[model samples]
Target: MHPTTTLLPLPAEAPPSLTQILDEVTTVLCHILPSSLSVKSFSTRWQVLRSKLATLKSSISEVSDSLHWSESPLLQTLLPNILSTLHRVQTLCDQCSDPTFNPGKLLMQSDLDMATGWLSNQIHDLDLLLRSGVLRQTNAIVLSQPVPGSGKEDLGFFIKDLFTRLQIGGIEFKKKAMESLLQLLSDDEKSANLVAKEGNVGYLVQLLDLNSHPSLREQAVSAVSILASASDQSRKFVFEEGGLGPLLRTIESGSTGLKEKAAMAVEAITTDPDNAWAISAYGGVPILIELCRSGSTTAQSRAVGAITNVSKVEDIRTALVEEGAIPVLVQLLNSGTASTQEKAANCISILASSGEFFRALITQQDKGLQRLLQLLHESSSSDTLEHVLRAIYSLSASESISRVLSSSTTFIIRISEIIKQGSIISQHISASLLSNLSISDGNKRAVSGCMGSLVKLMESAKPDGIQEVAANALVSMLAVRSSRKELVRDEKSVMRLIQMLDPKNELVSKKFPVAVVSAVMAGGSQGCRKRLVAAGAYGVLQRLTEMEVAGAKKALQRLSGNRLKSILSRTWRA
Candidate 1:
């Protein structure tokens, strides 16, 4: 015998490599292997081997950098999907490979946490797209619902198999598969296009009609955002699909979580002027007004954003103002919380910029001015104050309205005190409010008594402070033609202004430098211009000319031309 061990025959099923371990079996298997198997058996085994080889090759191809088909559209489209599929597949494989990733436990626990995090983010982005979703075909609300008997579905069986493999394979394998799926959906354009082609958008809309789950609502909203935002066509679909109605209802539905998103839908709807009209046609105005009136603070904020979007149109703005948004906002500025105060103040400020708003709102100056002053004095929040000052600036900017409030010495003194005590931002705003006060002759006299302090305030306050006060004061002072003007007789007054115009020794503390420079240029006559020029005004003017591109350049150009030569001629020769 070739070996001491005896065997009847080597089994056909034994692996070839195992034969070497058996001294006698190796020779016996070699001799018997060819005759033991029939042709049919050999063919069947070969087919199985071929199939296994193909699967191995497919898996290997997924990991290869060469498979990164950046050139072909088909590859580009399929690559992300293929990769995501493989990622999800591998993650599942790895989970089953380890016992720690048990389905019986919480899904968020252990390695499942990673997958849930990924899925949650995906769900979040998808939710953003839903309410905003504009399908290439048509727009519809989307809701997702889980179907029954999914347990017995073929996909479920494959999934079960994959999980089993994951338990044996490890978490790393499962993670790899999940990564591939995420990569595909991450690119918005590609994903949206694919979604359009597959009628996923339509299906989602159908889901929206039937489903009420918070998770489904969130996902649906995401898709809508993507579509409405993506194109005009998509937005049109969203409006046609009755999206706004549901969103408005959601705003009032008392779901704090959904309120913000509902408002976002309104914002997207009003992004285009035509859409604004469509929204108005759809009765968005009263809904938004009510949202502003009675919705939660968050809801109100969102409602305001929605209003702002539509307010770009003149009709929408007029509707809002007519609905008493202006007075309500003015009222809220005083009575609302800090956040509400700020929001109301900002909206009024925006409204005040419109000629219509000013005509409608500021016409009642004394009544409004009193409320604004109260806000200025009472609120401690810096944000509220800044915006309150801006709103005042916008409203009282008109000479007529300002004349009404200018009669109040109390208002004048309070404003003056604020200029002195407030921070730089406050100083800038205080200075602006002063511009409005100067519009009235009576108020000018009251402020002129503090002209000494005004001069000092000008010296220390910031450039923003200087801009409005100096510019407006110069115009108003020159416009007065008053020999009896309260400020004109103060000899040190002109002198103080001249010192501020000096450029060489820049007192960076000047609150409104740009405005101050402008005021000097505007009000200073040939002689006064000469004085400011001599006090090193040119250097600062030139520096500002170079530094700023807007109104600052216009001021510099005016000073450099006729004003400079004329002033020198008047001051030097005389």
Candidate 2:
């Protein structure tokens, strides 16, 4: 007859004392006699089981020293499973030692294999908890004052508990923890700083792995986005922790919602210009371009924004072009939403500013000029128009594109209209665009109608660059006799130009104003010369000439010669 044996009860719902349970398991494993078993296979299995228990004990001991291990929420939550598995090992060893309860070699070997596997898993879970550094963080954290209306709950302890839950639990537990953490981050910037300061950004970055659940990746990316957007320090933490690659991967392969969040995170991180090359290094340009090409509207919007930031790097801008971003970006100029089109326009503008080669890529290969002009006419949003005009301004530097723009009476007239009536920014960029257009002789006549608007902008002269650009445009258009006639005919235009030449008017550049005065003196009607002297031009010109301003001496010579001739002709008539 077999001796009756008592089995250990299942672990209770609540965690048991960690030190007591670990020591008890250690003693039980140490006292086991694998060599006493009759079957060699059973003895071998027992030996393996003992080896796994030793490893588990070593890992526990290594981590237990870092914190109040018995009270650690992570270790405490792990206790029930740890005890369950250890008790199973004990029961199996007891059965192996029992003479009357042999279940045969195969069943015993299978049972031993299952126990070993379970013990290995428990060890893995423990290692994951230890590696999380949550225990050390918890031990060192100083508890803050209770959050208002939370009934004196220790906010620091609660946050650490959430971190523990994230690291040491099943998918559902981690999901809840992620949800709660995200909720906390969303509440305020302070919470985001606290979470990021704990050095757990890598945990969130891990969730961005392609194998993770979609919803989990989405949550992780959303949390990362918040942290990156919170401040420059958190963004540095995200980059240092290797978050960019996974984020780019998510943009490449995640669902629409997930891609938007990931794109947003990428955008925020890349806002630090130093981080821009990492996107290119990770081959994110193609992914972002593809997203701009085919993602959902919101996804496309975010992808375009990220590209805008990433493209700030010179090499990434070339990579973007090499990835065929030009066509895709041009196509986005017609996107149904204003925000998407606006971002696409901003990105295209940036690309166009790179060099003439990129401008050709946007204008020649993709008809970007036409699309921007079309957007110019169709869009009512001032912000969208501002970017679109800026893009057109960028493309206007190309001669072929300039001809196309100058020939379009609608485009020229639109530039005129924007200068006259658009927002201050739109008007500024439009003035610059007109200045660029006026560079080509053929476009000079086309842009001559904008002379009044240009003169008005120069008269405002609040933002000095716009006034300078308008003055340069008038200088170019003065090559056309009629543009010269138009400028000198407007007394306000003549007065503004002379006023800009004053050394006291230091806000506007003297170079363009000097050029304008020289052009007007060289080409204007003699009556216009009289108006220059009348608008306080002689004093400003003499002072500028003394200062050795370029073109100032020639303008002074012309003004002096004209005045001397006028006096001689008057004296001869007398």
TM-score of each: 0.44, 0.75
- In TM-score terms, candidate 2 sits at 0.75
Residue 187 of model 2 has an lDDT of: 69
lDDT of 1 by residue, 464-530 (tens): 4464564454444344333123343455655565555444536633334445445545644555455
Residues 1-574 of candidate 2 have per-residue lDDT tens digits of 9999999999779744677776765565555434224434466777777788778778867765776455554555566677777777667776776778868878878888998898887788788666655556544322233355443224445566666567667678778888888777776566666677753788888988988877777788888878877888888888989999998888877777888888888888888898988988898888888887788888888888888988788877778877888888888888647888888888888888889888877766556677888999999889889888877777777777777776676777777778778888888887776666634556566667667677667756566577787777677677877677667778777777777788988667787778777887776367767778888888998999899988889988877786788799999999
The CA lDDT at 95 in model 1 is 51
Error of 2 at 279 (Å): 4.5
Best by TM-score: 2
Best by lDDT: 2
**Span of ten consecutive residues with least summed lDDT in model 1:** 135-144
* C-alpha lDDT (0 to 100) for residue 417 of candidate 1: 64
